[model samples]
Target chain A: MGVTSRGFAVLFLAGFAAQPAFAYKIFVSNEKSNDVTVLDGDTLEVIDTFEVGQRPRGITVANDGNHLLVAVGDDDTVEVYDTETYERLHTLPSGPDPELFVLHPSGNPLYIANEDDNLVTVVDLENRSMIAEIPVGVEPEGMGVSPDGSVIVNTSETTNMAHFIDTESHEIVANVLVDQRPRFAEFKSDGSEVWVSSEIGGTVSVIDPATHEIKHKIEFDIPGLRPEAIQPVGVRITEDMETAFVALGPANRVAVVDPETYEVLDYLLVGQRVWQLGFSPDESLLFSTNGVSNDISVIDVEDREVTKSVQVGEFPWGVVTTPD
Target chain B: MMPARFLLAAAFAVAAGGAAAQEAARLDPDWPCVQRKVPTLTPAAIWTGPAIEEAGDWRDDEEVRELVNLLSQRRVPQDEAEATIESFAEGLPAEERSARLTLLFAGLFDTMNAERSEIIEGIERYARHQKALVETIREQKETVEVSPVGTGSEAEQQLFWNLRIFEERRQSLPYICEVPRLVEQRLFALGRAIGTVVSE
Candidate 1:
């Protein structure tokens, strides 16, 4: 079956199930703790914690359900683990200072944002080797692959531009200027639009995925909270593409917005220095890793309230959900 | 008190001598070359007892010759600057003490490159000291818990006092290291600043 057809079936089953058919598993990477904590999504309890290399930041379950990939920033390598048993399988050597990464829909090409080199390194997941290094601006971070698997968007911290790279030719197709310190790009499920969050600029820029042009800018306002506090780090869109959650670093909250109107619906305060975020397999709950507090804030997506906070590891940073 | 006072006097005399040498060098461009052959005039060496004075054999000594060459030149030799500064620090005035000490440290930078032996040794020493204090406090606190119940005993009180003193000392080490590290860092900044100045 095609990838979209498979995704549709999963969504259909999830919609019909009485209690979210998919088993929700939470994967968290602790930057200072140097480990990954796996939590049972339904129970909101830590299931297992496993040792990873130094300074594990961004983590994601690969397109194939069996493998887990974590960016060990300090070690300069992405360690893959067997998701079923949570066992360390093997590690792929990434470029200098790998911070964040995204897997292509094909599941074979992995694009990593290396912060120090300010470049994106494209690696072939099948061969487990680097294929290309595209030079970016200062401190290139936060990556997203278009749903069509034709383009990849990388945001650089200092350059304030969202770079679009064509996957087929491995060339930068467009450099669209956004805001300062743009991080965490997320594409809609249909690949119609891409949303980029600017942490320092205190705004979210929604862009046309095809044209690489800014569609609209969403701004936030709260007294005593400067634009810096609203430093948005993580961006995630719902399966239906109706809602989006942007984790505001240092602002200590996540802003829920309507994707179509680009309007802020609500702001759910989570924890100190909130960095990365993820959703349950069923998409009913959202989990955010609070870097300073070293805990995960669980939010009920329907009500948009933080129901509970589960302590994880020291300086928890990145979080992901495993497919049932 | 006496030793400290004597060291202070000796430090001032050395500074006066250095100032005089600096003036003389300014007057005569060739004074440094001529002074290279002469012996260093140190208060300690000059004020040796009557017996040494009667012997009259203070000519061309390696230490004196090294010191003179270090102090008489417009720019001290990179190799001998550290030792010269160390010796000169003894006679520095109270207000100028830290300044001269800083200069002494700056001289060390001339001979050192990144990750040089002395710099690494200083860092290692600071790290080891911090680690030792942390471990010592942990062990002492463990002893306080595991020791036989004797809160009223003198030994227990002594342990309390010792622990308190250790804690205070441990708290100050970071500040102590900060002073030297800040000085060194500023020296590095000054070097960079000079490069920028020259480039502009």
Candidate 2:
């Protein structure tokens, strides 16, 4: 017993010493609470919750890792905050009801999906000015930028299409019809494929980037559960393109799929109404924001299991991790 | 109009009891909305002016019944509704104004709560119907795939049509989800509009 305690002390000291290398923070936007819950990425413990504007739905860490950008939908603005102090820096103008957004690979311009106005608002992060408002289909909610920063896609819930826009031109290049209520679009790291998740259609359509045609529709079936319960929403593919994780909203599970085969590998049962997901900087862990349950589920990526569930604020919607 | 706005704000505060309370109160698993699944709202949730129990039979009063019907319909704008309430109370005797307005609120609350409950039930039914159709669509697709139905064949065409119709129905869910909140807001506004006319 004495040796065990001494060994644990040394390991704790080692962890504290190595904090600089792996020190990161996970920011979760709670929609109802209108605040962001910040957690220590290493310990997976809540560090703080900072209040923001009304209806804070989408949140992301700026590429610089020094600032956090949150889409306050009701306020019709994207709020910027200091990452370390959780202080409000300023607000960027967005179109009405900005639900989700994505930063360019170069990290200068940010693309926002204005659901109410059916437009994608692009803003220059450095200057904090509106760059352009690219019109898309009805109720644009999901925003995705390609790895090369050439193309950005916005999924419209009512129109049921994935509208791809060229970043440089800020114009619609292609409108590929997917299943109904496509809530999210995720591009593979190599820019070879784009995966869009349809919430009501209950499938993820894999579109070929070059051909702009859907190559596969990945459907999930969990035994004893009705098909409608398996509503696909947020999707994320690993950097290596070996695996993909799709958040099955209201099904209370996350489906793991083989990116190459488009086959369901496993389902990790999470909290109630899991809508969004994020990955740790090293991709060692995946966190799911369970809106109804008001908690975030920590998934061990290597082990393919939920390791822990941490309670958060009300109606947690979006999540992003700092790269530091 | 000022009092109506205040009541509307109060109603929202009551409804925004956080997601944890919502989860605890929600019993229906198939509810598919971002808003809390509140089956019904009690008078205490929004009313703050007077005791509703002593309001008496609001339906028996012809004037109160007519006003209730008009106020319950969300088509009437809140400002217009408030003006109507103010004019009605101004015509009433000063001693009877508070009692009459309280009766008005009781009538509005009862009628709106019932409407909201009905809408919630309808939403649940819609979800159940969608679930059944999803199964049917899956089976139909499998049959079309297994049979010798060529592309553009009748069986394949039927499957395509069903899928399209299914999606069209699914698209209405978001709009339908807004109805309950709309009813609550209107009720709160009208209730508070009457409150403004009553003597403290």
Candidate 3:
């Protein structure tokens, strides 16, 4: 079993295709540093830190794992980068102040939440052109798309409504009002429910995607923490749609909840001001971007414990993993 | 005079670790806000109407300066501010409206962004002072614990008051943290109002 370049390449390809996940890189957007910290997922070590546009907050990898998109709010553009080589590819014409965005499940057009413009700018990822600028509510920051790419949900922080848009038409189909300062929206993998996290309202509203009505409101009550401090920001529901992980901003914990029962199963403490979350491809590990603490807390999903804390750039705001 | 043990217990009660943790997370260790410290705001963040250079030498215009002062005051309600901007634009001749509105936005951005920056600096200073107070309290507590009985009374009294002050400021931090955001929000609203006038 002598190691060779060809053999290593074959093994790498096979590793991604088969079980026993390949060495995926975790990308974290540092808001203040204006850079992305790349960490080896398997080893959980800092591989590289690359400079990005100003105020890079929301970050995600393309479905094919070829490109990485970063929403640089101050730059007012989604910066595209070559994921493998960390090369600057091009920029998407994201409307003014793009804080967060979501890719179509198939990964074609990128939907961005322009916080300053009150619009969701849809950009064609392949062609690198603006497709549409759909008018949304005030301070639209959080964006999510359905598994089938039929609907796109934009949660407006000030308006406190989840505006669901029909992907094909680019027109708002429904507006489901939730609590105040709805900062992030997440859809269950099965598309059965939509979870909106309200930062100021301190609650997570579980909306029935079909009916466009509130199904349940999940609230946090950590004994020692103040109610106002328990603000919910980002949410990730498991592919099975049985469990959800909600990042409680400033409360410094991610609440594990049973999406079926709407009960908080447990609260795992992470770094301060946990803003967003990302999961490994296998769903075994979860990574949280802790803004104030400048680190990512790696949570063991099955154990429900924070296994490791990896320090990165200043004010880390978003996290995403490579598909491989 | 408070007893040494009582002073020691109070000294141990200081939240130095929490304060240190908060400071350690940031580049300027003094920044205590959970919001990423943006020391200053770029005009692009709020002002989307026209290039700021178009409104250069806005300070030379007394009326524009006055309007900037009036509008930048957060005490003035947003709706009232919008009405003022609309009225100001309406009173101007159609030819002068866009230039005047652009000037107004530039002045407002300059005034408000500077004000916001000052507030952020003040917050950092406040946090720095708070950290010093924690350090002093820690030292005084050690003195009270190790020193012979009544000799440390003066240090104990100082430590007690410093602890009280630290706690008071810590409790007030969350509110102070909102000040910069509030200022930015006002600037955003005012900028939009000015943009509406220019468009109309």
Superposed model 3: Cα runs more than 4 Å off: A1-22, B1-200
Higher-ranked by TM-score: 2 or 3: 2
Clashes of each: 3, 0, 0
For candidate 2, lDDT tens digit of each residue in A208-245? 87889999999998765678778999898989887789
Q: Ten consecutive residues with minimal summed lDDT in candidate 2 chain A?
A: A221-230
Q: lDDT tens digits, residues A119-138, model 1?
A: 89998887788899999888
Clashing pairs for model 2 are none
Can you tell me the DockQ of model 1?
A: 0.01
Scored on chain A only, each candidate's TM-score is 0.91, 0.94, 0.93
lDDT of each: 0.70, 0.84, 0.84
Error of 3 at A104 (Å): 0.5
How would the docking of model 1 be graded?
incorrect
Cα deviation at B85, candidate 1, in Å, is 63
lDDT of 2 by residue, B1-200 (tens): 12222332333343343575457337555675666686776564345567888889999999999999998988888778989998999898988888888999999988999989999899888876766666666677567643332345676666665565556666676799879877865775566456555743
Per-residue alpha-carbon lDDT of candidate 3 for residues A1-324, written as tens digits (9 for 90 to 100): 556888998998998788654588899999989999999978999999999999999898884887899999998889999988889988989989999999998878899999989999999987888999999999998898888999999999888899999999999989999999999889988888889999999999988889999989998987645687788998998897767899997677899999888899988767667889999988989999988657898999888977777889988999999976
RMSD of 2: 22.2
Give the poorly placed runs of model 2, Cα more than 4 Å off. A1-22, B1-200
